[model samples]
Target: MTETPNLKIPHGGYVVVGDGRRALVLRNEGHALHLALRVQHVFEAPPNPPTREQGTDRPPRVRQGEHRSAIEQTDWHTIAEERFADEVAAALDRIADAIPALIVVAPPRTLASLRQALSERLKRVVIAEIDKDLTKLSIEEIGRRLTDG
Candidate 1:
């Protein structure tokens, strides 16, 4: 990893940290990093669907008498993560010009979703990607992680 100059913000760059449920956008000011944005969007899926009282309802068989089960469906949690990633991508796109460099910190799953959601334009400015869930870390800890090689 190329050592950053005291981990200062590259002009108007940003560092983003998130998981499936929450995200924190930060920017470096002088020698400190501060919260530049905060998204508290949460996806609360019901414990059970109206049709089923346990887990998600499985799709009905294609044929009434067919022995094969319906194709497995995507989980609500996965869908929510994708949607959150899209939201993050859109937010980054909106501030593309202001942020020339970006450091993304998220879990492996969320990182994958974010990678898929990012547009080509936004991809160009991504400087580093840390595959770890840092959403719960304090600001000082986050700064240390960003600067630590």
Candidate 2:
């Protein structure tokens, strides 16, 4: 975590806490002053190893004229993370109709991916975006952080 923003999650508001591998959606059950979050949905992606482990063959060779050039190896881990972002966006779209407002919390890189995956209507529902990885924190601890931090 870098900087903690002042946040007040109103009742019926939703918070999407995620990173590259996990996305946890929580709904606020209490008022703005007292935040009590209840887990509504969770998306946990399968473990994605590094490119070296996931890739079987070496970099592909491109033939140009008489010389051969090796293309850069693909990053499987980054691809998996991007796909995970799409899944999270779909989940948020599914629950958007029920939420009054939304707050998104993710690391800087994941946040950009999520922002791109989310729909226009769903984007409008987002009231705050906190660039931090709060997925590992307990629900109680998250609530405390939102209210106190």
Candidate 3:
């Protein structure tokens, strides 16, 4: 782990943590903190092929039963990871520069991935890791976990 300097700890507040592809915004409530998780997707627009009849009045034809399931697909995990890494790097740059003393709380895997990608100076920033899976739990449940911890 790279040594980060001037780590700042907050008394209490809300922070949005995620890898861009997935994110959880944790906010402190009066009793407990609420966690709102979000998932983002980077979609590539398909190119429209040039046709000789560009000015034709014919509309695009619809192919029934030709749809493919985008769900239940892991073939693009690597691609998503790469894109997510890029997004994380950008976000970290902003965070490290703008909020040098911000306290970060995240899951173990997320912390590990962020640690590996963050700079030595940024690594010095303090973070708290919670093992709970925000995606699988409700906001109220996440708040309970945070308060319970």
What's the lDDT for all of these models? 0.68, 0.86, 0.44
Candidate 2: where is the Cα deviation over 4 Å? 1-4, 65-68
lDDT of 3 by residue, 12-121 (tens): 43333554246554434332133332222222323323443333444345445976343332324434545554556456555565433333344565555555566665
Which lDDT tens digits does candidate 1 get at residues 18-98?
A: 886777877654333433333323333233333333345665556556565686655666776788889888887887777
Instruction: Give the per-residue Cα lDDT of candidate 3 at 9.
Output: 29
Which parts of model 1 are misplaced by more than 4 Å? 1-11, 31-56, 63-67
lDDT of 2: 0.86
lDDT of 2 by residue, 1-66 (tens): 233455788899998889999999999999888888999989999977768987857888999999
The candidate with the higher TM-score, 1 or 2, is 2
Ranking by lDDT: 2, 1, 3
Best by lDDT: 2
Q: For candidate 3, what is the lDDT?
A: 0.44
What shift in Å separates residue 138 of candidate 3 from its native position after superposition? 5.4
Give the clashing residue pairs of candidate 2, or none. Answer: none
Residue 43 alpha-carbon offset, candidate 2, angstroms: 1.0
